[model samples]
Target: MPVYKAPVEDTLFVLKDVLGIEKFNNLPGFADATGDMVDAIVGEAAKLAEEVLFPVNLSGDQEGCTRHDDGSVTTPKGFKEAYQTYREGGWIGLSVPEEFGGQGLPYVLHTAVGEYMSSANMALTMYPGLTSGAIAAILVHGSDEQKSTYLPKMVEGTWTGTMNLTEPHCGTDLGMLRTKAAPQPDGSYKISGQKIFISAGEHDMSENIIHLVLARIEGAPEGTKGISLFIVPKFILNADGTPGTRNGVSCGAIEHKMGIHGNATCVLNYDEATGYLIGAENKGLAAMFVMMNEARLGVGLQGLAISETAYQNAANYARERIQGRALTGPKAPDKKADPIIVHADIRRALLQMRAINEAGRAFSLYSALQSDIAHRSADPAERQKADDILSIMTPVLKGVMTDRGFENAVAAQQVYGGHGYIEEHGMSQYVRDARIAMIYEGANGVQAMDLVGRKLAANGGRAVMAVFKEIGDFCEENRADERLAPFTKALKKGLNDLQAATMWFMQNAMAKPDNAGAGATDYMHLFGLVIQGYMWGRTVKAVHALQDAGDSRTEFLANKLVTARFFMERLMPETALRKARIETGCDTVMALDAAAF
Candidate 1:
């Protein structure tokens, strides 16, 4: 069976040592999240992941989801039961506020548990994953009545949620959407449209599915400017707040997808669905963007989760699969051949996977910590600062991590040779699953463009400059630390490359706009590499601190130092290539005429 175990120890170390999450206990919902309490919470989550979710991953991928004549969908055999257990355990509302039927924990804690569930089963975890983003959206922009009616049930997982933005004719261009919401006599709107790829759209796991739909109100202005958001449930609510009459929404068909089969991706038909407006009259895109942003971060987590699991399974296979004798000598004399792990080539792949994944984890956690600070900090400046950092990191985490995550999955598959290609081993599923993260939640290319176009100039470039300063500060502080000299030096070079790339874009993008578009992906990746390098530097610093304090995890810290060195010396050079690519402008890219191609 393809199995997974949460990297709990590493996670705890990052949470406590690297990020120093303890100082944030003064904030609301973090009072009880001390080191021991955090450990217990993660331990319980690990059990649920191992016992409940991990066992069904391969089966869920194989069986997929089934749609019925009545437009209801059924998940894989064990999925509904597992969801109930998740609901009962308060897992759905892990970080939600207590007033709304949640545990009232910090967002970072939720992220830790989310990573665990994601690694256990990306397909199954998505059923609840989309719901959390929906919850975030409603909490931020929903009306009082909407919150009272939706938050409690959704938080408890008795009812799930989904976002409906894409239409048959529109994908990235929401202005092209044709979905219409006509105002009703009783203050409800009648929604009519077709929405495709609506994940968890009509699942049997929940009593009702609340959809945050993007629709244009009748007679509203054209394009994205006229868009409006709505709360269109599968079943309309009764006077007592219980699910009552059936709504006009129904799934027309379930998509036959490449992966994430356990969660229903539906083609929804809304024929005059009774809907309630959210946010302003013609500003649906503004409201929906909140959920989209949250979903983007969640999608990035999918990338990290799949790569982590793929790495674990691949590492295990390498240790057990017998192959050619070691180049040096027969490491296993009794056996005809040594394990494949003894081969230097295989070791290279494994180390690359390890370095990227560990750094990805830190990148994710640090971003989540920023989110908590942004949302919960008492000081206005602190909140604004964290929010700025988060705005920049969001696309970086989504685009860069998904790209690297897909790469790692492919590399892990390569470790198994032909066996990896077969479905029985399940590596192919990871690849297919990871592929969607890059496309959805705004394609990685779009994410890159957003990073450079919108985020770079935001607040007079404060966010990007702050990140640059952070790297410079770390390098300055560690300049004389002989133990950390190599890693610091590499980080400095990566920072220089990143700054050069930024300067090139600023100077060239004005004369030729395509220069920015052509190099956006490369620039985003360059930024990702520098941020990951910073993550590793902080991780090494944390390890050294533990060692200096006479902590007993010396051997583990040594391995961590080795991985940090590998990332700095081996992987960090990619920034140079990326920067070089960025400086190449868009000559060849735009040189070809449409007819010539």
Candidate 2:
């Protein structure tokens, strides 16, 4: 069985030492997130993940989920009880506004804890993860009544939520969607549509499911401009805000997916379901993007979560499983043979995953802090800058994290040799589960295009420019510090590669659109390398500071410094390759004829 222990101490280091989260105490929830409070929250979440969630991961995957004749779905064994524990603990509402029956903490806390939950059991965590996204959308776009009716229960974990966008004929192209909503006399619409690939769509865990669906109103304009968002519930609400009559919605079938089998990915059929519009007419796509953006970040974290879990199991196995003797000689002369970890190749693979996982965690928390500042800061300029950074980094986070995360999972599996491929060790599950993060929440390809196509040009390139300047300034400020020179120097080199690729896109992509399409993925990864490199620089500085002050975490600090150095030496150089690919443009890529295949 696979084991998972939340990186609580590492998270605290990132939160308190590197990011200095306490600096934002003036912000509403950050004030309450003292050292003790943050420690308590993260430590408790770690206990739940290790004790409650990880135990059921393998069994849940084996049992999967079952759909009954009555169109009701049941999660695997122990899931309901686990969910109940999660609800009673007020974990789902950790960062929600207090008005919505939540603790009203900074979103960074929720995000930090979220990695543990996802790593423990990704399928189970999706139950509340999707709900959090829906709550964020409703908070921003829903009416006063909608918020009052839905926010509290969803926040309290009684009622869960799902975003309904894709249909039988559409996945990314919302304009081609065929779902329709007809206006009624009572100010509600009759929604008739079928949405597929709806995660946590129907389940027995929650009292009701609120689906934020996109549909076209009768006689509305064509294409995406006509699409509008609607709140369609499984059970219609009564005057007292309780679930009353059953609505015209049911699970048509549950999808048999490759992984995350514990989540009820349902084909939901809506037969004239009573629906209320959330946002303005012909503006549903914009509102739905809110959920997608949140989900994209969550998906990126899933990549890291799977990588972390897989790495742990692989590392543990490497230390215990006896393999060939070390190249030099017998490291364990008394034993039958030396442990796999004694080999240089094994250590290289482990360090590769370790290096990325550490820097990836820092990047995730740092990006999350940007979200907190973007939403909570009092100054408009601060908010704008934070939002810009978040916007530009979102695609990079989603695209590069998952891409590399899946790679790390495979690498972890490779560490176990033949044993990794077998189901008993549970490494296969990690690889299968990590695969979906790259495809969902907008495929990595779309994320890449969004980065190069829309995000780079937004507001005359202000966001990307701001990020570039931040990295450049960090390098300039830290050039003289000998302890930090290695990280900053590598980061500066990576930043130069990323900037050169961006310039290539600006100069070449416009003349030939195929150039943008051909090179977008490389550009996205190039961007990710620099961002992660920048995070490593900060991590090294923080570790050095802690060591200088004799913080007493001698071994942990030493390992972190080594990992940061590994990242700089081994991974940061990939930016040059990505930049080279981007500069190659699309001539050969697009040269193939339609009949070439």
Candidate 3:
């Protein structure tokens, strides 16, 4: 069975040391988010995750979710109750606006909570995870009436939300989606479409399901420019803010997926459903991005969460699973064999997971901090800069963290050897569960394209240059820190490599579009690794500073330094390979004829 102990100490290090949660407490609406309150919140969330949710993780996978013929869905046993517990505990509104019955906590702290929830049970967590994204969208783009109608219910967990963008023939190509929405005399539109791969689309965990759907208005221009967003509820709300009659929405079927079985992936059919327009007509794609950006970050946290959980399980197993004698010699002569952790190779795997997980945690928190800055900054320039950096980092977090996260899961499973392959051991599930993170919420490939093709070139490359400057300043600040000297040097080298790769793409993209396409994925990973290296260095500096000040948890702070070194030595080296591939240009990728293979 899978066992999860929340890494609360490490979480605090990232929050207080790396991202400065103390400063966040001084922000508007965050006066109550003091250190003690933050700790209490995380403590409760961890307890719920480990005690309430972790126990059912394996069972959820085994039972999966069931779909009824009447178009309703049933989550695994204990999921409904677990969701209720999550709501009653105020977890659902951790970072929501205060006007909507939320605690209004900073996202930096909520990032830790998100990681814990996902680690406990990603499958069940998706139900609320997606709801959070939907609620965030309405909070940002929905009209006041729309917000009044949905945000409270969503924040209260009485009504959950789903995002419907994918169709049978369209995955990443939203421009090709065929869903249609027609304006009616009542001002509300009538929506008709079939959407696939809708997570939490028809779950029984909430009283109402609100779907933020993308469709093209009638007589609108073709392709993406004509697309519009609509709010389609499973059941319409009455005058008193309660679910009234059933809407013309039904689940046709559910997909049998590789993982996240506790959450339903439904094929939803909307037939003349009453839909309210969100934002302006012909601007649906832009509106959907509000939710997408939030979901992308959440998905990134999914990556970090799974990696942390997998590493803990693997580390615990390593210490207890005694096998061969130590390579240096028999260290446990009285026992049958020494623990696997004594082996250098086993240590390598564990250390790699540790380094990546720690760095990933810091990176996610840093990104969340940027989000808070973008949302709450008093200065327009500060907010714009934050938004630019956040936009560029979002794809990196989603793509690289998830890809590395899946790798860490595989590494953790490898530590288990034969035992990892068996389902009953619960090690294999990590790998299975981690695989979908790469595919969903925009595939890592799509994320890479967005990074290199769109974000890097946006605002005439100002965004990319701004990010480079930030990294450069960090390197300069930490160049003198003896403990972080090596980390700073490695970060500088990685940043140079990223810049070189970007220049190569910028020069060649116009001549050969395939050059960008070919180099997009690897380049994204390269950029992510470099940024993560920078984050690790920052974390090391913060932790060392705290240690110098005679703080408690010196051992934990020391571990941060060690992990920073490990990440710089092991994980950051992958950037060299990616650079070589990007510098090779599009020759190999575009060389083959259509039918050559």
Error of 2 at 564 (Å): 0.9
Q: Which stretches of candidate 3 lie over 4 Å from their true place?
A: none
Model 2 worst lDDT run, 10 consecutive residues:
1-10
TM-score of 2: 0.99
The sequence of per-residue lDDT tens digits that candidate 3 reaches over residues 1-597 is 778999898888788768786775546655778889889988888999988888888999999889887988898999998889888887888988889988888877788888999999999888888888999888878999999889988998989999999999999999999989999998999999899999999988899999999999999999999999999999998999899999999999989889888889999999999999999999999989999999999999998999999999899999999999997899899999999999999999999888888888888988998898889778789889988999999999999889988999999999999999999988788898999999988999899999988999899988889899999999998778877788899999999899999989988887888888989999999998988898887887887788888998877777777778888888888888999998888888878899998
Winner on lDDT (1 vs 2): 2
- Error at 569, model 3, angstroms: 1.6
Ranking by TM-score: 2, 1, 3
Q: How many backbone clashes does candidate 1 have?
A: 0
lDDT of 1 by residue, 1-597 (tens): 577888998889889999999988878877879778899999999999999998888899999999888777888989998888888999889888888999888888888888889888888888888899899999999989889889999999999999999998899999999999999888899999999998888888999999999999989999989999999998898889899999999999999888888889999999999999999999889899899998998888888998999999899999999989999999999998999999999999999999999999999999999999999999998898899999999999999889988999999999999999999998999998989999998999999999999899888999998889888999999999998888899999999999999999889997889999999999999999999999999999999999999999888889999999999988999999999999999999999999998
- Candidate 1 global lDDT: 0.91
Model 1: residue 495 alpha-carbon error in angstroms = 0.8
TM-score of each: 0.99, 0.99, 0.98
lDDT of 2 by residue, 484-585 (tens): 998898999999888888888899989899999999998998898898899889988999999999999999999998899889998899999999988999
The lowest-lDDT stretch of 10 consecutive residues in candidate 3 is 21-30
> Each prediction's Cα lDDT score?
0.91, 0.93, 0.89
